[model samples]
Every structure is written in C-alpha cells, then in structure tokens.
Target: MKIFELPQTNPLSANRTIPNVDSRGFHYKDFETMKPEDSKLGDAGFYVGIKATCVYHSQTERIALHFLDFNTRVLTMRTHYPYYEEERFAKKYLSKAPIWRKEVATIDIDILYENDDFELAQHGVSCKDKEEEFLTQKVVRRSARDHEFYAGINGTWEPVVKNYFARKEYDNYEFILKHIRKSNVLALNEEALIVSQLWKKRGLKRPMDSLLEPFARKIGTDKHHLFRLTCVAIFLGHLRLDHKYEFNLRTPLRLRPDGVYQFSRGVETAPWGF
Candidate 1:
C-alpha cells in the first residue's frame, strides 16, 4: 500500500501567516486536529491545490489522483475512467501508469460538522443493522414486509435519511487529508474494494438493500453501486476496520509432500492471515 508523500516545500505556503486558514477564514488547526493541512502547509499556510496519483500495489493499480482544493474544501478526485476516450488514451499514452476514472466520488468536507445536530449522521455506520430489528417491531408484519422494512426502526425515514450512507463520504474526506499531509506518501486506496468484492462474491445482499437503498431512494442513486464506495470508508477507518496486518505469536507450520513440517508464509506473503 505505497502512497504518495507530500513534499516538504508546500505549494500552498508563500507569504502566509502562522495560523493558516482557508478562503472562508476558517483557521487551520494542528496536524492533530487538521491532520495533513498543518504538515503540508509548510510555508504557504494553506494549500491552494493538490494533484497526486493514487497508485496501489503496481502501476496498473493506478486508479485515480486526488485533486483537493483547500480554498473550497472540495476534493475533486479525477481519474481516467468511465469514458471510452479516457480508457483509450490511458492505454496508448499512460501505459506504465495506466488508470481508469469511470466513477468518481466528490466529497464535500463541510458536511462533517462536529455539532450535536449531526448526531444521527454519525450513526450512519449502524443503519443497516438497525433496519433489520425494525422489521419485527410488530407482530404478523409479514403482510407488509416491504412497507415495514422501509418504515425503519422508529417508524420514519428520518433516521435512515440522516444516517444514510454518509460515514464513508465523511471518512474519505478525512482520508485525503491524512494521506496528503506527507507530500511523498503514496495513499493506497485498497482494503475496502477487496472487502466489498468479497461480500459480493459471497452473494450477500443485505448491505445494499438496507444501508444504501435508503440513500439511493432519497437521492436517486444505485444502492449497490453506492455500497462499494461506503465499504471503502468502512474499511479505511480504524474504528470500523483494521486494514493493517500484524504478525502472529509464531509462524505456523505447513506440511510438505515428504511429510516434513515447514514454516508457512501467509498468502501474498503478508505478515498475518487466517
């Protein structure tokens, strides 16, 4: 998971003040609070723009490059995807660093307001589980299973609407800032895709219908498609998912053809796995 590192000489800092702030006059906090902005600000105070390629394990895994503009706090992640021309251009021109940008996630950071008003929004991660419990709130509800399911836990769509599928979008906004803090770090947007694909392969359909379906109904998006994006954020966050690998107490043994026990290297030679 090699990520690009932010350069020491920030393109944002130039004739700037100590307390960095965006165009809206929102003063920047330390890396502890502001994460990458404080470190990447360098001397520019606040970054005006950022352009970096997001390469995963190899060149082919070069999915997209995040273009973050601090002035507007709008992370416009542009990739060579969805369009046939972009694909053909990538295949012919950017062969070594080929990428696809078919689908994109434009995150507005302003939504993550750390206020009490957005408390339900914070529970977006738990909406799916809650939806199931609501199904059986009343007896003999099988007659209106479809209606009851959508009615939700508290008999309204307010929770589903507010909670929706925002946790992922909110986290993505933070992830960009975290990775961009170091000018040279290569942010590998992995784990989530793999996990989501694993779920799809397993033929699980609850997450889409429960977690993302509500959002799609309200906003007119494909629930299944939206879940993939949500999974990425869920996998990225430490609280939700631990993408980092850890070694075991001791290397496990593997049986060879000759009946000899040999130390086993985990699949992909990763440090640990089941």
Candidate 2:
C-alpha cells in the first residue's frame, strides 16, 4: 500500500516558479503534479525507472537487464519491477493458489480486484482468509502466486519496499548486468529458439560448468558463446536457478519445476531496440 513520495504542493522556496502545465498536461497545485526531473537525488535514472516504468535510452542495443516472473514465466521490461528487494514487509501475507472465477463466488471472494481501464486483471490472493478471501491487496510479494507486485503506485516509493521475490527477480537481472558483457549478448546473439535445443525436457539438475564445453563442441560453437546463451536461457526460464545464489561456472540449474517450457514467452518482450 506504500506509494512513491512526490514533491509537496507548496515548495519551501519563495523565489521558485511553479508551472501551469505538467508533462501529463493541465494539472492541479498538488505535489502530485511533479516530474521526477525536479528531484534532488543524483540518481535520477534510479527513481525514473520506478515512477516512469522506463529509463531514457538505456544502453540495451548490446545488453539490457530483464526480469522474469518465476511463476508467470514471463519476462518484463528491465524497468518493470519493485525498487527494494527486501521481503520482510510481507508479514501480512498468506499462502494461496490461483482459483477459478466460477469457484470464487461460492468459495473464495477475498483475493480478486480490477484494473482502472478494466482491460487488465491482477490475480493475487493476499492478507485475508486462505479459503474465503484475499486479505491485503495494497501490497504483496511477487513470488506470491498470481500477485502483481507493481499493482497500483506501490512500487515508486522513496525508500523502496522490501520484497523477497522482487529481490530475487531483480537479483537475476543484476547478476546479468554486472557479469555478462554487452559484447557477450551481442556476439553470441543467442535467442530462445537456439537455447531450446539445449537440456530440453531433461529436467535434470546440473552444474552450469557441466554444459559449457560439451554443448560448445556438440554445436560447434565457442564455449563463451554457449555459456552466455545458457545465462539467457536461465533468465527466460528455459532453465531455472535458485537466484538467491550468485551465478558462477558451478551454478546449479534445472528445468523449471513445473516441467513446462516458457519457450520465449517472456524474453521476446524485453525491449532490445536494436
């Protein structure tokens, strides 16, 4: 339920001028009309990513960080995730599985809600009766089944909320950014279609190092090329990882527990402008 903090309606300075028009067009005098460009924080890109759902010209032509929902098996744009990765705020949450619409009226009515345009539906069950209703819709953990952590303005806060699943998700993206080079993503040009041929339906858990040299030799490609592709596969859910642990040559990977392959369901959606 926590929302992002924006500038107050009345500025502390007497000499500053407030504009009549804001980026969204005509607006009221409330602090709600702010553009983050006005914020004092030096890391504008950090806050911008939360409030605006994007960063300007993120250097993605080569490599872009992306988030993959473990449950939905969908990859969202790099900007589309919670700010804080901590999950302690979830003290109010409860474990619940997805339910059918038909079963809701007769059984569970506590967990569902609607989108403003009604064009989108979020299917999270939280902070309420496990069998009767979903409790706290205001805030939820992403790892929680069917919950959209970014629901409402909850994700754009000043001190980002702590979310475990969100952290894990971000961790996945962060690891790629720090270790994998843009040259690697571009040079190999590995796509889901290419990765699919790997470890297909094996559902076998194996160390990352195990696949590298062999797959490279099998496909007649370089080990470095095949390794980066494997990382991409991990992010796209063609393979699964603990994520809480950092990636290394020895990282353990297994088929998604569901034994279902997302194929390219999420990775394809990542914005790689080039």
Candidate 3:
C-alpha cells in the first residue's frame, strides 16, 4: 500500500502550511470552491456545506485519514456515496436556481497496483495523452451556449490535475477490489479523491473583476443577497456542479441538462426570493 506522508514545507508560508484534519472537508470552506459528492457506497456524513456528499464502499475511514497532514478552507461539507440516486432537496425553495458544473471521472488505479503486465500494456500511453483524454471524457464538449458562456468572459483553461485528483474515483470501485486485493487508505489504494483545493498546478484563471456585484445590480439586488440566493439555487439543484474545472466569481453562469428554470414572477414579495 502507498502511504502519502505530509509534504515538508517552509515554516513561514501561511496558506501552504499543512495541518492534520478530518477528511470530511470541514476545513475547506473559506475558499470559493465547490464540488459535488457523487457516490453511494460508504459512510454518510457532512462535508463543507450542509449538502450530502458521495463516496462509495466501506473505505470511508481509509479515505478520512488522508485529511491529516493537510489543510484547506471549510465552511460546510456533507459526504455520502454516489452510486445511484435521484437528486434530493434539503428544501423546496431551491427549485429555480442555476445549473453549474458536474464532472464524472474514472480514476486509473491500474497504475497504483503492482501488476507489471498491466503497467507494460498501459506504458505506451504518455501522461500528456492521458490527461487530454481524461478531460475530453470528464468535461462537456462546448455546445453553442457553452461557447457563448466562455466567450463572454474571455475565459481560458489548460490541462491541470494531470495526475492529481482534488476529487476523483472509479465508476465501480469494486473493480478495484477485483484487482489490488488488499486494505489500505483510499488516498493510496484507491489512487484517491485525495489532494486539497490547490495543487502544484491549477487549470484556473480567475476573473480580474467583481462579476457578481455588477450582475447583482443588473438584477436589482445587492451582491450579498444575490450571492446567498445563488448559493441556495445551486444547493437546491438549480445549478449542477461538475468540480472537474475550476471557477471564479465572473464565470458566465448557465443552466444545465436543459435551460434555466423560469419561475412565474407573480406573487413573489421580493426579487431574491421565490
């Protein structure tokens, strides 16, 4: 089994310092990052927000220990298994929100194992080709509207998380059971949904200005109130989250699987509420 010891860092850097914590992600909230828990196979618990997270199999405890020796921002994190289930609401008020990003990726634990034959067979694949194929599979191809969304902001992206998974997993992790028959931390054995919010390289270029404030004004609401409403919309399923790509404040928001849900504007007492 592979053990990921905490990286040794300088004693002075503030944000980069590592601290042992729980894998529940309780320590990763202050930063503007979002991820969807898409599993249904392990222990259920809260993550950064009051949202339900996803993890599969009985390897939860193994996964949790990796939280040690690292640190990140956290406000709320709800974790669960992400096998098969319908979207559930923590409340009814979130019906008309926006759809965000959602990424479904298959991690190659094949490399993490000791199968020399598999390695030689897969050895011909270059890391560069592997990452490109991974993105093509995980990120949605740009639709007309997707093109428009990125164009509006002059956005840019590059292949990041090449071998690092801020979050990642297999479709049928039992597949892992069929191969690397052993017990160890998921951080190593599973090839892990390991790693914190930031890494040595990130595929994000944050917008330079305040996109939320300006849009709030356009919609006749203050940024704070609008921001909260947006969060609610996301939590309520108005927005879908594919954590594969990184985002900043000004990313042109769009609905997914379909278009945005437009609720009847009548009888609503406030602009920010239903």
Candidate 4:
C-alpha cells in the first residue's frame, strides 16, 4: 500500500483553494467559481481533510491500498503576545521595537503504505489483514509548535516569549532583563501544576523531592533549583504548551540552554513533563 500526497486546502479562508490535483476529484480554480455549499466548507475552519483509494493489479495478483492523512496547525501568537512582552519588559528596556503580529500557515505531511500477492483464505479472510501486516500506515496530526520553523529553537514557550521581547525591546536592555526575572516566578507556578498532574497520573509520589529528582537528572542540573525554576517558567508561558522544548532525557543534554530542554528519541527521557 502506498500513500499518495493530497493537496492541502484552506477551508477556513473566504476564498476556497486547493493545492494540487490528480484523478480523485474536480479541482476548484478559485473560491468564486465554487457553489455556495462548497464554499461553506472554506469558511468552516476545517483546513485539513484526507482522501483514500485502492487499486489492484490483475496480472500480478497484487493488491494496493492508499491512505492519506491531512492535518493543520492554527497559530495564535497574538493571544500570548501581551504576556510575552510583559515578561520581556521590552517596551521599557529595549532600544529596538519588537514585532507583534499573528501568523498562519498550512503545513502538510504525506505518507504511503503497500502489500504484495497473498492468498486471501490463509490471510484472515480479509484484505485488511494483508494490508495491515504488509502496508505501512501514516497518521498526521497538528504540530504543537508553530514558530520553530521560523525561529532556530523548537518553539519552547519560554524562548518564544523571550525572543519576542528581545527583538522588540533590544534598546531597553535593563528593563528587559528585569522583566525576565519577574516572569520566571509566574512560569514556575504553572510548571508545578503541570508536573504534579504528570506525577499523579503515573502513580508516583507528588512530593517536591520526587518531582525534582527526575527533572534534575533529565536536564543535568541541580535537581531542586531546576525544578523550582521550571515550575516558574511553565506558569509564565515561558514553557508553552505548543512548544516542543522538553527536559527529562536519559542522557543529560541541553537542546536549548535558555529554553526548555527536550529529550530526543531512544534517550530514555522521563515523560513527566508532557
């Protein structure tokens, strides 16, 4: 089974648009040309959709199933900008002005899955079984972080806020510095709540020491201090929900020294921070 790429569409826009076309369906040239009902799908905010199809080769006795997964990431940067700016204290301290605006984009992930000749009777009496064993399935979901593509960091909550402030208030260095310290306090509070929930879900002790132990080893830092600081960062949105930054890896490594720490795959990282 092979997965074919489906054109991405922005159903949320006033103008309905489709990215590409093959043989699956009729392509709309523009929003105006579409019927009223068809156009409604555009305004519905369902930016992502999927289409799947299957084909068979008679001579080869081979069966193929195609699956397409569509997903969208809606970005809302402006909602957090006020808090971001406050944390940076950019307006008072930075010499340079920061840019405050929201950006939206449609991203796509395409995958393919396949199967060869097989006896149906022996293979659980269904094509799905053959396809399941031989074919690879791909699932696509919205990305948690939006700014990482534009920014160097992986869109950790804290770093994004800091970056925005830094850019906006570069000239007001003193004030920005002060705001960062203050922001840390609020972030930590939120972090504590999130971490506590993670611990409870895992049936672990909720004591401060238990929480601190995993974080300390994960980040390769002082367990108690880092835990306290992390909690503050989360509360302030310094460590954001959509940010990909994380700590708690098997190996002690800092992906972002200034932002949240993330553990890569097969690293035996602790999952408490999620």
State each model's CA lDDT, in order.
0.27, 0.34, 0.26, 0.26
Question: Over the stretch 1-274, how does candidate 2's per-residue lDDT look in tens digits?
Answer: 2111111121112122334442224231322222336323322243121001333122220012232122221112222222232242233233344333322111000111112332212222121212122234522322342223334423211112112123344545556544443433323334533664666743146776777777777778788767667665554334554443555667555444554422221232243222
Task: For each candidate in turn, give its C-alpha RMSD to the true structure in angstroms.
Answer: 25.3, 18.8, 25.4, 24.1
Candidate 1 local accuracy as lDDT? 0.27
Q: Rank candidates, TM-score, best first.
A: 2, 3, 1, 4
Error of 3 at 184 (Å): 39
Q: In angstroms, give how far residue 53 of model 1 lies from its true place.
A: 3.7
lDDT, candidate 4, 1-274, per-residue tens = 1111112122111122233431222232211221224321232112111122112211011111111111111110011011122335455357575444322222121111111221110000011112233234321111223223323321221111111111111222222223333333422454444553443344133344555677666546576555555434432324322123223323121223233322111222332121
Position 50, candidate 1: lDDT: 40
Better model by lDDT: candidate 1 vs candidate 4 = 1
Clashes of each: 25, 11, 43, 33
Best by TM-score: 2
Error of 2 at 139 (Å): 13
Best by lDDT: 2
In model 3, the worst 10-residue window by lDDT is 118-127
Quote each prediction's TM-score.
0.17, 0.39, 0.23, 0.17
Using TM-score as the measure, name the better of candidate 2 and candidate 4: 2
Q: 1-274, model 3: which lDDT tens digit per residue?
A: 1112222111112223222232222232232122224334333232221211322222322233122111111112222211111243212226764432342112111111112121111100011212354355434342223333323433211221223223222111222222222322221311111111111022123341355465456557666544444433333233433333233344533323232222111221332110
